[model samples]
Target chain A: MCTCNKKNEYIPYPAKIESVKKESFDTKTFRVRFTDKNLAESFQYKQGQFMEVSILGVGEAPISITSSPSRKGFLEFNIRATGKVTDAIHALKKGDALYLRGPYGNSFPLEELKGKNLYFIAGGIGLAPLRSLINMVMDNRDDFKHVKILYGAKTPADMCFADELEVWKKIPDTEVWLTVDKPCDAWGCSIGVVTELWKETDVHPENAVAIVCGPAIMIKFVTLALKKSGFAGKDIIMTLERYMKCGIGKCGHCNIAGKFVCTDGPVFSYEQVKAFPEKEHVI
Target chain B: MSKMIEKKKIKGLLKEAVKQWHTYVPQKHIGGDVLIAPLPEEAKELEAALDNISLADDDLVISPKDIFFPQLETMFKFKKGEIAETVESSPKLLFGIKSCDLKGILFADEFFKRDFEDAYYLSRANERLIVVIGCINPPRPGACFCTSAKTGPFAEKGFDLQLVDNGESYFVETGSEKGEEFVAKYSGFFQDESGDAEKAVNSIKAKAEKAVELKIEFQKALDLMANDDFIPEEKYKRIGERCVYCGACVYTCPTCTCFNVFDNAKGDEGTRVRIWDACIFEGYTREASGHNPRNQKWLMACRRYEHKLKYDKAKTNMSGCVGCGRCLASCPVDIGMSKFVQEITEDKKIM
Candidate 1:
C-alpha cells in the first residue's frame, strides 16, 4: 500500500493568460503565468510533457506544452479549438483565467539522443508536442550533433507557428524542410506528405534517432518508412496522444491494455508502443 | 479479549451501533432481498428493512462497494471559477458485512492505493469501521466460489472485527485496536469465554470451509491464461453478442475501481465529478478525433477478465475478482469471472 499523506495532485493552480496568438485556422497559442509569483518561478518540467487546461465551467483538456522550460516564466499551450472546453478557451481574452495542472506524462530521454543526429517529423497539429523538444535542443545546441526537422500540413494555410518556423530555420547548424500536401501560392517548399520528406535526408540509421508525432494513420506510414530504412524500433520515439483525464493515472480513461498512457507514457518508443492490445491501441 | 453475543441480543447491539456511527447492516429491503444498506431514514420503513436482519441472511444482493467508491461521486466543485473540496461529515460503520464482502473491500483498498493513492476512496475507506461476520453456510451457495479464490468462507487479515457463530452464542474476535475499543463501548453485550479460544475458532473455520459448495481450480485457470491456452474466440464472441452493456456487474463488483472524470459546468458554477466507468462502454477510451481502441465488444469482455484474474494478481498479490460472485449474479448475459475461469480450467465437453 502507498502513502495517502501526499498532496492531492488533482488540484489545479490558477493561471492568468498573458497573451493569445493564433497559430492556425483552428489552433491558438495561449501564454499563461501562475497567479502566485512563487509558484510561477519554482515550477519546472521537461520537453514533450502536457498540462490539463480547464475553463472552470466548460471542462478540461490535455494540451501539450509548446514552450521549452529554457524560456523562463510563463507556459504556452497550442490548443486546437475542436471540442466544448477548447471552444470556450478560444472565446476567452488575454486577461482571463484558466485552471492548470501537470507537466504530466513521460518525456523524450534526452541522454539517449545527446550525441546522435536528431530527425523530427511532424504533420498537422502534431507539431505542437514536438515543438517543445526542437526548442530545447536548440537551447543546448553544443550537446547535440546535426538536427533536421521535417514538417508538413494540408496546405500553407494549415501550418502553425509561422513566425517560429522562420526563427527555427535561422538556427545555426540546423536543417529545416517544410512541405504541403496541396501546393499553394504562398508556400516555398516541395509538395508531399511528411514521410516523403525523409527521402531527402541521408542521415545514417546507426547514429540517428527519429522523433515522430501525427495522426494515427500518419504515424503508421512514418514508422513503416523508418523501419524499412533500417532504423530499429528502439531508436524511434513518439509522444502518443490519448484522451486523458486526471493527468494522473487514477482515472482509467487513458488506459491502453493495462498500461495507463497518462502515467507510463504519453511518450514511448516504437518497441513499447507495439505491445498494446490491437483492439484498444492504435499507433 | 474474546467474547460472545447470543442471537437474541443482536438487535440491541445494532441499536446501539446506530447511535455512534452512520450504521449500515444487512437487512431485507421492501422487495425481500437481503442488502447491506444504511438504516432507513424514516421509522415507517424500518420494519420492512430489518425483517431479515441476521448474521446468516442470503449473501447480500449488492456488495458494499458503493459505501466508499460511490457510483457517482462529486469529487470537487468549481464555484465562481475557484475549486472547493468536499468533506465527509460522519464516518461510516458497515455492520454485519460477510467475510467475502470484507475481502472485496480489502482488494479495493489495495487497488486504489497502487502507485497513486485515491483520496476520494481513501478518505472514506480509512475512517470506515468494518464489522464482518463469518459465512458458514451462505444461502446463495450455488452462486459463489469464494473458497477457491482464497478470500473467504472467512476472512483472516483485513477486517477490524470478526464474528463467528458457535451454536447458541456468537464468538467475537477483534482484528484491530478499533475493534477492541468498539467491544469496550458495548461491554455489557459480550461474555468472556472459558474454553480453549484458538481451538474453538478453528473448529468454526473448519465447519465453514466444508459448507462452501462451489469450488474453482483458480491456479490452473491462471496457468492457462498465462500460457495463452485461451478458449475459442467464438465462445467470447457469443458472450459479446448477448451482453447489453448495462454495467450492473461493474457497479456490484467488490474490486472494480475504474472511474472517469468530467467537469459539469453550468452558467458560472460547475463541478468536477469522478464517476464509475466500465470498459465495455464505447465512450470509455474513444479519442476526440473518433478513434476507439476497445471498440469491439469481445475485446472489452476479454480485457475485463484479464484485469480481474491476471493483472490484479500480478500487481497486488490479490485477484481483482475476489470470487464475491456479484458479477455472476448481476450480469444479464451470465458471462462473468466464474464462468470465464471455469471455461479456462474445465474440460471442453463439461463446459
Candidate 2:
C-alpha cells in the first residue's frame, strides 16, 4: 500500500491569453498559449475532461476544455460570465496570465463508441464539451458510422459556435439540426425545443451511442426521448456538473451519493446513472 | 513494559519533555476551568491535570482533531502578481489525548488519506507525534458508549505511545517506531521490568472495564441503522427539534472531515483556504445557482446519521463514531450521537 500523508503541491503552469473571442452575448472563448510551449504540446486531454482555470486573485473554476485535442497549439475554454470567478475571467484581456491545474476527471470513452452510429444532443452552454468530441469524431470520420447532431439554444443570439456548427453541417454523412426555444423572423432554425425534433430522425438503438448535455430539465427530456426511441442504458452517456471546490475530491462538494464527480466521474454511462440513488431529473 | 512514576515526577517529566520538544498538555484556562493548552514552565507546579480530572460529562473541552488538523492553517501563500508559492510545515508533540479521541484521529487519517489523497491535510498531519493517555477512570455522565464502540479507556492502535497511569508513574507501551524512539530519548526515566508492569496494567484494565456503564452490540446497531427497516419520521424530528443548529457537534467531531475551500485574495495575491464545514449548515451543499440537494433539517439529520452509520461504514469498514462524547458536551440543546444511538437501540417505539 502507498504510504499516507504525501505532500503533492499543485504545479501552476503559466498560460498567456493569446486571444479572446466573444462567442455569445454573455460567453467568450479564450485561446491560451502556455509559457512552456513543450507543456502545451505535451498536454493531452480527452473530451469531457475539465481544467481548473485560475485568475490568481479571483480563484479557480472548473471549466470544460472546448477545443478538441486534435486541433491544438494552445488550449481553449468557453466560459459563461456567471459567478465571481467567471466575471473576473471575463475582465481579462490578451497578454494577461492565468494558471491551469488539470485536465482532470474521466472523459468520454470515444474508443467504446467506435464503429457505432452516434447521436449528439446538447442545449445551450452544454455544447462546449460536446463540441470537442464532435470535432474529434469528425476528424476521424471513417472510424464512426452514421452521425446525428441535434442542438438547441435559448435564442438565436444565445447560440455558441454557430460558424463551427455550419461547417459540421457541410460534412458528408453527418446530419446537423439546430433548434431555438423562441424564433426570430430571420432565424432559419426549427422553432421548438430540441426534443421536438426527436421524431424527425431515425436512429438504430442497438448499434448507436447517444451523448447528451444541457440544463437538468433539458437533459432529462432528452434522455427520456432517447430511451423511448430505443437506446439502451449503456449506449447513452452524459456529463454531470456540481459545485466542486477541490478538483481533487477532498472538499466534498461534487459528491452525488458516494461518487465524486472530480475523481470518479464527470462522464458516466447512462447505466451508471440509473443505479445512482439521486437519479431523479438529473441533467 | 509499564513502569511507575511517582506523582511528583510528573511535573519534571513534562518540563524535561518540553525542553526537548514542543509539548502540549491540558492546562487551566479562563473561567476557572481547564482546557488543552500549552504546558508552560510555571504551570508544571500544579499536579498533572491528566490524572486528577475525569472526562467531561457534557462535551470534551477540546477536540483532539485540532492537534493534527488545526482550524485555520495556511497551506500555501502566493505573492500578488507573482506565481511564487511557499508551504508551511511544523513538527510538534501532543501529550494528553484520550483513547476515544485517539481512535477518532485514526479515523480521520484513514478518511483523508484514502482513495483520493488530500495533500494539504496529509502534509499538516505528518508533522505531529501522538502520545495517548489511557482512560483509567469512568467517563463523566454523558460518556458511556465508547467501550461499546471498542475505542475507549485504552487504545490498541494509532497512537505512537500509550501511557497508563499506575498511581505513582505511567506504564508506557510503545506502539510505533516513533514511540520506541521516544522511549530511547527518555531512557533515563525508564527501567526494564516487565512482570510488575503487566500486573499493574491488568489491574487498571479490569477496574476500567468494570467502571464502564455503557454497553451495546455495536455491529447490531450499525446493521439496524443501515437496514431499510422503518425509521419513524417522528423520531427523526425529535432529534432535529433538539438540535440548536450550533454546529458544535460537527466542529468537535474528529472523524467529521468535511471542509469548504475559499480563496482569500487581495489584488492578484491570495491563498486558498480549506476551512472546516459541516453538512448541517444551511448552505453546505447550496449551488451557485441556488439549488440544494439537502434543504431541510430532517434531511440534514438523516445525512449525518447516514454518513456516520452507512457511508463511512461501507467505505472504511468502521463506524464513523469513535464515541468521543464531545458532541454530547458541546451541544446546547442536548442532542448528541450517544442519545440518538440510545434512542434507536432502546426505544423500540421509534418515536
Candidate 3:
C-alpha cells in the first residue's frame, strides 16, 4: 500500500497483469502481480479501498480492490467497460504493464463488525468490493455472528464469480440468497429486484451491520428496505461511485460539498450520507 | 512597515527592478487589457508607454489564482512504466494588481494551506512574489462594495510589495521580507523619506475610502443566515431564481476555487490535468448513474451563496467572497453579490 500526499504524488510501482478472466460479457477481472516482491509482500488493503490504475497512454481510474487481503501475491479488480478509461483497461491482455497508486480511502470497520451479524447486499457488479470483506469474515467464521449475503444482478448471465458464489453456499452459518431482475429457464436464483428479496429476510437488524453496494438506484431502494427493517443510520454502510478524475481530493469532481468522496469516502454511513445537503431519494 | 518612494522616478525604479525579476504590469491591447507580456527590448518604448498607459481596470482579466493554482499543470509524468522525475518553476513578480484581487489570492492561500496542505499550490506560490498596486480609482459601476467586505482599494497581506501611485511617482511599501530584499538590492533608486511618506499613504487611503459609496453590514447578514429558522427555502429560491446560471459569476469571481481533473492522453504517455470547474454546472453534482444531488439550478444558486457567506465563515473565520465585483461586471442579468446582499437584508421575507 502506497501513501500519497495531497497532490497524490507518489512513487509508482510497476505491475504486470498475470491473467484476465471474463466475468461477464461486459466485465472482466484482472489479476496483477507487482514488480517489487517486498512491496507486494507487505501490500495490505481493507475492504472498500480502491487503487488508481494507470494505463500509460490511457488515463487513470479508481477501481475497487476485489481480492481479499487474506489472499496474497496478487490483486484483483473487476472492471466493467463503462467509460473511456475502463474501455482502454478492458483492451489490455495478460502481461500488459500498468501503474498503481493507492489503497486509498477508509475501509469497512471490520473490528467494529466482528461480534455483529453481517448483512451483505450487492447488486450486479457491486459484489467486487464487498467480496473482500465477505471472504475475510469467512476466513475467521467463528469470530463473527450470523453472516448472510443477498446478491442481485440485472439478469442471470450478469452475475459475477459464479463458481465462488457456489462455494460460499457450503460455508457453515452462512446463507447466500441470489436474485435476478427477471426469471430465466437456466437460472435457479430468486426472481425480482434485490429489494424484494431483502423484504423476505428476517434479519436481526439490532445486532447487525449492513454493508450494501450497487448502482445508485439499487442502493437507494436497498437503503430504504434496510431502514424499514429497523437498521439504524450508522449500522448501514454503502460504497458510492462518482465521476472522479483525480483519486485524490484535489480534483473537485468527486466532492459533495466539503466531503471529497475520493478521499473522505467511497464508503459512508447512512448518517453521513444524510448530512449531505443535496441528498435526495431517487425512488 | 511601509515606506515611501520618490514621486518623479517611478518608471526608472520599475525599469531597474525589471532587470533582475520577471516583472508583470498591465498592458493595453486591441481586445482589451492583458497583464505584463515580456517587456519590450527598446528601453525608451517601455518608459514612454508607462506614462500614457495607466493600469487597465477593464483589462484586468485573468485571476491571479492561475499564477499559483494553474488550470492545467502536470503533477507528474510517467513514461515506459517508470515515473519521470523533473520539477522546474521560475520566480515571478506581478505588478499593478488591485487590492481586491490581492485579497482573492489571500483567500486561496488560506484554503490550500488548511488542514490538509496542498503542496502543489505551496510549491508554485513559493516561487512567486506579489507586488500590489493600490486601486487609486474605484472599479466602474457595480464594483463599489469591496470596502464593506473589508478587502478593498488597499490590502494588508499577500503582497511582497505595495505601490501606491502618488501622481508624480509611486510610494512603495514593503509587505514581506522578499520585498525588503528587492529594495535592498536596488538601494540606489530609493532615497530616505522625510516623514511625508506617511501623510501621502494616509491621503491615498482617505481618497479610496471616500470613493466607496456602497456598504453592507456583512456580520448582520451572516448572523441572520446562520440561524436556520431565519433563512427560508422559499426566499432562498426567490433569490436564486434571479441567477442566470451562466457561471460567469463563478468564473470571474476571485475566490471560487472548484476544479475538475481529466487526462489528455497520447499513445503511451498521458498527462492528468486539473481544469476549472464551477458548481453552477448541471453535471457538477451528477452521479455516474445519472442521479444528481443538486439537481435544481435554484438549489445550486442557494448553495453558492451559503457556502461563501455562511459555511466558509464558520470554517475559516473568513467570508469566501473577496468583493472584487467581477461577478457584478460579468453577470448578464446583474444578480451578483451586491444585489443579492441588498435583497437578502432588505427583504423581510428573506430576513
Candidate 4:
C-alpha cells in the first residue's frame, strides 16, 4: 500500500488567550478560545481529559482541562509555571496567541459513579482537573447523591480556586472542607496534609467514590488514608501527572508499567496505580 | 520460477537499480563495522577510494529503525503559533536486509500505529521498498539468534522480494506487486532457477536453523512475568544496580520504537522534531515538577524486560525481541535480553 504521503499529525491550531485569572502565585488559569469559530464550538471533552498547550518556541505540555464541559465556548487550563513551556505560558496575557492540540486521555467514568456520593480530594495545582468534573457533577447535581470536597494546599498562597471552593461550600447538598498545610490569615481553614483531613471529615466510603490528585508523595499517603477510611482500591480514582513530550502515545516519556498516561490514562483507579510499583507512577 | 542474479554483475545490478530508487546497500566502514547507506554514484575519478562492497556479510550494526524513524527529523516547521511547513520524503529501497531486521520493521510499524499514528515514521515507512536477503549459509555472523524468536534465518512474507545466495548466483522470489514490477523491468539481470530454488533454500535454512546459538527461555520468562505470575528476585536489583543507563541496548535494538519530540526555536520561528528516546533513562518518564515515577534503575530495567517479553506481545501478538542479539551485543554492562531472561528464568518459581 503506497499511500505514504505528507501527513503531519503534530500540526496545532491557533488559540488566543481570551482572559487570565491569577489562581495562585505560581498558578494561573487561562481561558483559551480556538481562533477558529467552528473548532471552538465543536471541541467538547469529558472531565479528566487534557489538552496540549504549546508555547511557540518553548514546547508543548499536557494541561488538564480546568473548565467543565457545561461551560461552553472557551476552554480553561490551570497552569503552574514549573517548567519551560509553562514558564512561557505564564508570560502570556489576554489576546496572546498560542497553539493547542488534543483533548486527550480517557475521561472519568461519570456513568459508573452516578447515584453514588462523590468524595473529591485535591491539593494545589492538582485541583485543576478535578475542578472540571466537580463543576460538571454540580451542574447535574440532581442525578448524583451527596457531594463532598476535602481539599488542601501547601499554603494559603498556594491554594487555587479559593473563591470557587467558597462557592461550592455555599451550594446546598454539597460539603466543601478546605485546609492548608500551614496557617495563614487569608485562609481560615484547618492546617494539615489533605490525608489528615480525611479523618476529620465524615465520608461514607461504601457508596462514595474517592477521587484524589496532587503530588506523588501526597497521593501515596492519601491512598493509604482512603484505604484505611474504608474506600476500596477500585473506588479511589486519581489522575496522574508525568512529563509528557507528545500528548499522544507515540512518545515514550509518559509510559508507566506499560501504560501510557497520555492515552491509557491521566485518570486511573487506585487499583491500577497499585499494580505498578509505588515508585513507577505519580498516583 | 525464481529468478537468478549472477554474482559478478551484482554491483552493476545495484548501480542500475540506484538510478530508479534510492537504494541502500550494506558497506563496511574502515573500523570493520558494516553500515547501511545509499549506493554512491560511480565517480570515475574517485573509484579507488571505495572498497569492494558486498551485501552478504554479517547484518549491519544498526537496523532499518534509522531508515524509517530516523534519529533526528523535522515533524513540522512552525511559525510562532502555527505550522508554516511540512517536510516531504522520497521513496526508498532497503537492500540486503535480513529476515530478523525485516521483522523489526514490522514491529516498529505496529508501535507507531498504537494510540497515535507516528506521522514522522509512517511518512517514511509508506515510501519504503524492502528487499530481504536470506542469511542461510553462515546463518548469522556475530551475536544473532533470529531462529529462537521465530523471526528468521529466512522470511516467508512481508517483504517486496526475497533473495538467496546460491553460491554462483541469487535465486530471487518476488513477494509483492512492486517486486514483480521491478523483476519485469530488470529481467536481464535475472534467470529462472526456481526448479532447484526450493531444494537449495531448504538446505541453507536447515543449516542456519541448527547454527542459531542463543537458547534463552524467552516464552517461559514471558509467561512468568505476565500478570505478575512470578516476581523476579534480588538478581533484578543487582542487574539494575549494574546498569549505568547509558542506553546502548535501546539505541541498538531492532524492535525498540520509543522516541521523544522537542522543538528547536529561533525566537518565534522554529521546528518541532522528534528524537529517539529510551525508557532506560530515568528522565524518560519523569514529571515536570521534579517527581520521577520510575526512580529506580531496577524499575526501568524491569520495564524494558516486560516490554520485550510481556507488553509488546499483548499488543502485536509478536515477539518484541527479534533475537538479533543487538541488546546483548551493545550492552556495556553485559546485561541484555538474553542474559536477563536466562537469569530470571533459571530459578523462577512459576507457582
Chain B TM-score, all predictions listed: 0.90, 0.87, 0.87, 0.91
For model 3, residues A61-99, the per-residue Cα lDDT tens digits are 788999888788889999888767788889999999877
lDDT of 4 at B325: 80
lDDT of 2 at B138: 53
> What is candidate 1's lDDT per residue for A34-125, written digit by digit as tens?
99899999999989899999887677888889899789798999988887788889998899998898889889888888988888888889
Model 4: colliding residue pairs: none
- lDDT of candidate 3 at residue A137, scale 0 to 100: 90
Instruction: List runs of model 4 lying over 4 Å from the truth.
Output: A1-7, A277-283, B40-52, B85-87, B137-142, B227-231, B347-351
DockQ (Cα-based) for each candidate:
0.49, 0.40, 0.35, 0.53
Candidate 4 lDDT score relative to the true structure: 0.80
Chain A TM-score per model, please list them. Answer: 0.96, 0.94, 0.93, 0.95
**Which one is best on DockQ?**
4
Segments of candidate 3 deviating more than 4 angstroms:
A1-13, A36-38, A278-283, B36-59, B76-88, B114-119, B225-245, B287-291, B348-351
Q: List the residue pairs that clash in candidate 2.
A: B5-B168, B5-B169, B58-B329, B59-B329
What TM-score, computed on C-alpha atoms, does each candidate reach?
Answer: 0.93, 0.90, 0.89, 0.94
* lDDT per model vs. reference: 0.80, 0.75, 0.75, 0.80
- Candidate 2 C-alpha lDDT tens digits along A159-270: 9998888899899989998899988889987878899887666756968999988877787888889889888888899988776776777777677666778878889888
For residues B1-351, what per-residue lDDT tens digits would candidate 3 score against the true structure?
445666556567668767765656667655655544434436787776565444534436556677776666665666556666433355667777888878888888887776456656766665667878877667544455778888867887778888887775667888899989877877877766666778878898889777777777666777776664465677667756777688888877778888775656666665655677887788887754466767787777877777788767877788888877777777787667776677678774422
